[model samples]
Target: MDDLIVKVVVRLAGVYENHGERVYLDAGHRALLGIARAVQDEAERRAGVGGNKVEGPVIKFPLDRAWREKKDRDDA
Candidate 1:
């Protein structure tokens, strides 16, 4: 999985445009958020916020619960 992500980063970096960097950064941020969300404990998640003054909760559900909710919502 880490290798796959590294490959994606390399591919994104190869693109010769400013927008490619923006997209790559967005993907990186999402990856970090996913990692943070996977960790248990609200305090840990909050710590992951790292002094950023975000208005709401930093992380959502774990991957499984998030997928299940998404599937349920889609089925409905």
Candidate 2:
């Protein structure tokens, strides 16, 4: 396993041993929340806000192609 993953597992085990199951679960929950928040923040940074734009690669989703094709069909 990766070093970071190993460290997190060790830390969580220590938490469970010292605090109990509730604290360990809370720690894991909080870590997941942090990861989700970071992803949202990064997405907003890349997508920009208001009329202001940022210099970054555009992220295209699979649904984007379907939408474009639908729009083209409608226009034709």
Candidate 3:
């Protein structure tokens, strides 16, 4: 997979023309764009920010050893 990605990137290397010039994207870039679009659409469909989401300043804490210990203590 790494080799394939490298090969595609190498193929994409070139001196691009100035703006307004009709240029075609490499096969790799086209495929990547398609895949990205598909993934984005799927994510949008599955990820619903409906009435379940609460509006607020959300704070995220790292799950470290100390946090785990506190959680265990609280559970007990």
RMSD of each: 10.4, 13.2, 14.5
Query: For candidate 2, lDDT tens digit of each residue in 1-76?
Result: 5998999889999999999999999999977876786677677777874442435755433468789899999999
Q: Which model, 1 or 3, shows the larger lDDT? A: 1
Q: Which is the better candidate, 1 or 2, if ranked by lDDT?
A: 2
Residues 31-65, candidate 1, lDDT per residue (tens digit)?
67766755534565567754434466664434797
- Pairs that collide in candidate 3 are none
- The TM-score, computed over Cα atoms with residue i paired to residue i, of candidate 2 is 0.59
- Computed on alpha carbons, the lDDT of every model, listed in order, comes to 0.66, 0.78, 0.58
Ranking by lDDT: 2, 1, 3
Misplaced by over 4 Å in model 1 are 1-19, 41-76
lDDT of 3 at 38: 58
The TM-scores of all predictions, comma-separated, are 0.33, 0.59, 0.30
Candidate 3 lDDT for residue 60: 41
lDDT of 3 at 10: 59
TM-score for candidate 1:
0.33
Ranking by TM-score: 2, 1, 3
